[model samples]
Target: MKLTNKITIIALAAIAAGSFLALAQTPANNNIVDEIVWVVGDEAVFRSDIEEELQQLRAEGSALPPNPYCVIPEQLAVQKLYLHQAKMDTIEAPEGQLNNQVERRLDYMEAGLGSREKVEQYFHKSYAALRNQLREVMRTQYIIGQVQENLTKDVKATPSLVKKYFAAMPEDSIPYVPLQVETQIIMVYPQVPQSEIDAIKDRLRDISERVNNGESEFATQAIMYSEDGSAMQGGELGYHGRADWVPEFSNVAFQLSDPKKVSRIVETEYGYHIIQLIDKRGEQVNVRHILLRPHVSSADLEKARLNLDSLRNEIVKGKFTFDEAARYASHDKDTRNNRGVMMNQKTGSSRFEMQDLPPEVATVVEKMQPGDISQAFVMKDPKRNQDVVAVVRLTSRTPGHRANLAEDYNQIKEMYLAARKQEVIDEWVEQKIKNTYTRIEESWGNCDFRYKGWKK
Candidate 1:
């Protein structure tokens, strides 16, 4: 009873547009009653919810399903089933993950709308209120995902089943594997001068001292100076476990027992920070901090580019192999030890489709052929929040072709496992719908549903 692709797309669009909140508010038409359209267990689905979803779909210029009235309510009803099961099982959504997701969503909204103020204006609520609402939506999504995972955790695609599944597929039904490449890179981080590092540390120390001496509030300092996304909320990082934070940040954050004390300057991959404890609950701690990053001078960047250019020329002239150079000279820790072969984090593989590479990397690699080394180029290293110079070698390329058992076993296996998992989930949803108590308004129940048991 999971939502069909059309419904799922509409739901995601509505959520992003903040139309989900319309369910709780009255419709603009004063004559139309906000009547209950369906009830599943103790939860009620209102007509306004369906109307709001439809309005969001129309606003986005999305084509509506022929039976949107029936489809939308059924989607809501199925969500209720998953939610109810999650509650019964006491499945708690990870708060740290939820907080991070909400923050990212807020950041995206702010970026799109031009500022935090515009985001609030667009949502018609205060930032805190909007965050809470987004948090609940994200929490529901997380719990539903967890519940679905729980139901299908044991489903697997064995080798025999994979072969059988591939054999049964019609010739036209087989998927096309896209052209992918394996790239090797050598990266050099532009060195920050000690003077810049010392300057940042000194600034943080001054901020910490001011807060400790009651000359300034830590929150105010964070708002004024913190470089992190949490600066909008006065650098407040809500309660999160030590595992949720980098070790350097968590170690100092958890050590703070006094709310009045300001922490010593702590350095992390992101930047330098001075923390102030807000509260602690069990293993989780909430804190506020201001972050400052040492500036990478133009001279340093030029030096890095020159060094990488020299190394690339040497490798191109066969003075040393690309892999050999990367092993000793590359600053990218993730790939340096692995002979500079980049792995796709999403797929846990050594191959990447063109669009999957970082934009800068993709642009350079697109024009390169197998065994060709690229010229030195500058790109942002998101992991360390710095700009780095690098050269890449396109080691191998696989051209696009139809998937087959011999050459595409792993890909086919993944496809089979995903299909099997969906089957298990769909069957579970069907049973849940049959067993669960449901009531629909007669007029709303007139249309057909994908799942049969909902009518009764």
Candidate 2:
């Protein structure tokens, strides 16, 4: 389960302030003892809870906040408030979706800590016991998420409010806006010769036959031959959405209903893949595939370059608009629909930060002015792990500067809305605490809490 966007900042800050040495280190001869750290309403926060969270945050290299012991218990108490509200409201994530999330979390932990066995050992619990504990944690996290969303559902900012907020900030304190650019591209994927395509299909067919005949297991074959990163994990890509996959791969993968059946060779931008369905949970699925990419010949590469050049010429000469050309001629599925304007996945903005830009895209963008079209060039597709030809157009550019209301209205507006939302949550918390039966152990009340109402 994930925290809602609104509360994650507060949650992280509160979480980082504490240390749980016992959770971080296990002594060989000593028994681990957990005690009640705080009590909120009918719920109780345990020392173990703080330690587990602290251990995970520390492992992620997050900076610790001041007075963690006091800070973390307060956060836990606040979390319990939301969870209690969630119960009163009868809120819950779907059982299937919750189980999927649980398995995925376990998979990530296992992969990171080396293996499932190692994870169990580190936690000092059997797999079943650990799963049960994680289920409760995930359930509470989701409930808290629902509460956060409900609290801030009406929060918004107007242009006037945004301007006022920006005006109120000291000039020196205004955030620095980084250099950003909006780029458009028409990509040309080299066509694999029929012979090369046929060769790949033949090889996949052989592997399929081997798996069907019990001569080899699908995961075993994947380990020996799959080119993708999932090969190391026996080709198990944990539960993911249909949108996460290319059309060709997802179409064939979602069609396989039987665990024992191997799918036909499916061709996507990545390459030829033979899929094995591990399981399905609602709309999401867990599947494994072995990817085999065919070699693109020099002639094929030149052909693609020439084809893209023709499209670029049409766009540059004003015979066709760049967006028109991109819609009809660009082979990139991700960008073609939106007129080739590349979206920054990190920021969800049309403008890309320099460091976040792909090396090939950055090189062309550096030399081009806004509205300048680039010549056909070879660049690597990071996702497909293949080289292809493309032509780019730099649509817009912004120089680094201190943010102002005129140019950074959205950014300032977001800040204003966040501050307003925080105030609303704080007021709500004060009322909740006054009404709820809360008793914090006196020993836990010594730290400087951002929310003083917690002491009441």
Candidate 3:
């Protein structure tokens, strides 16, 4: 999920610079400086590959050490170990999958590299030729991932092991567990009464009628009436797949075949829509629409607020427990099952690192103490189209600290398991490098490696 360049560097994904015929000038052991840094069976690790990634890193403003060449070799060694294992285990992607992924990624890389022509010019090849080279490299990476996943499939965690793992970590080496608080609230969307919905629908039907009657152009009417962001641009949302859009909108949009005909009012969470499908291909559709959300009734807000006040009074009087109240009364489904214990959706754990919590929830939690409940307040729910009133529940709070076995067993166990897994993988790689066919280029004859037997 993270496209961050820093995370990519820290992961040490594929380490090795491609060693080419025209790389660093070194004619030490070999008469010709061109040498293979290491070989895995028939495949070789060159200085070029690592150098490219390092150059990419540097361009991204990474502060790199002067010793990237050394670090890259080890990374390349690990990647080769994985690559070798992948071939052995038949972890290979079909030509078609690699082709598709390469094509999709190429689009992004092309944009990043500036343009299609620019990219082709830099690589000194036509688009098709460049794609073929990228495909081969991508296929190797894909196979390596499959091999690693296969090896790690059986890794399991246990409570006792998790505890011991945390205990073994040095105090400073342990990650600081962030402060978190849990709470939940019930939200009632700002009210749009039936009459208002019907009025908006009627107005949309009139627009559709005008377009159908040929009295007015669809784009012009849309410019004057459409409420969505694309209104100014003639209501063109461009071509999009069904999966990319909200279900209700896509279902109707994708179904429309006639360009001249205007569709019925489509109701999505965004609002009511009257759409004109411009075109379609298989599961993809292009459409333009006018959206209208009904105005919220003040009476609806009062009704919700009055109900919340009654609920609050009941909680104060101990007539109903918070859990029971949330179960029977809360409208938000995510927390309703957990008795309204509002954990972050992005992180499954109940605790939210201060940075990880949603802004609205964080603001509420920041000003409150443990066990305090906020007065009913209205806030906009990002998922919904309207404002809603809900009370905040400030449960337990934990501050940042060095992880301990008692307070942070799960995290410790994860870290311990990860460390153990890394050690096991390292041992496996060491054995593989020793047993596999390997030859360091004469130019790299003097550089030290963790596995000394690789030279033979």
Q: What TM-score, computed on C-alpha atoms, does each candidate reach? A: 0.82, 0.86, 0.70
- Candidate with maximal TM-score: 2
Off by over 4 Å in 2: 1-34, 51-61, 109-133, 240-251, 280-285
Ranking by lDDT: 1, 2, 3
Worst 10 residues of 2 by lDDT: 1-10
RMSD of each: 4.7, 4.8, 7.9
Error of 2 at 83 (Å): 0.6
In angstroms, the error of model 2 at 299 is 3.6
Over 4 Å off, model 3:
1-37, 92-143, 199-265, 270-303, 448-453
lDDT of 1 at 113: 67
Best model number under lDDT: 1
Q: Give RMSD (Å) of candidate 3 vs. truth.
A: 7.9
Per residue, candidate 2 scores C-alpha lDDT tens digits across 1-456 of 122111222322321232222332432222338666666776677666666556555664677767778777778777767877888889997766566666676666666666668877876767776566556656666777788889999987878888888889987889999998999988878987899999989989999999988899999898889888777667788777777788898888888898887999998778899999999978888998998988898888988898888878888899989998889888888889999899989868788888888899999899989999998888988778888899999998999999887777777777898889889888888788888876777877777876656665
* Residue 73 lDDT, candidate 3, scale 0-100: 63
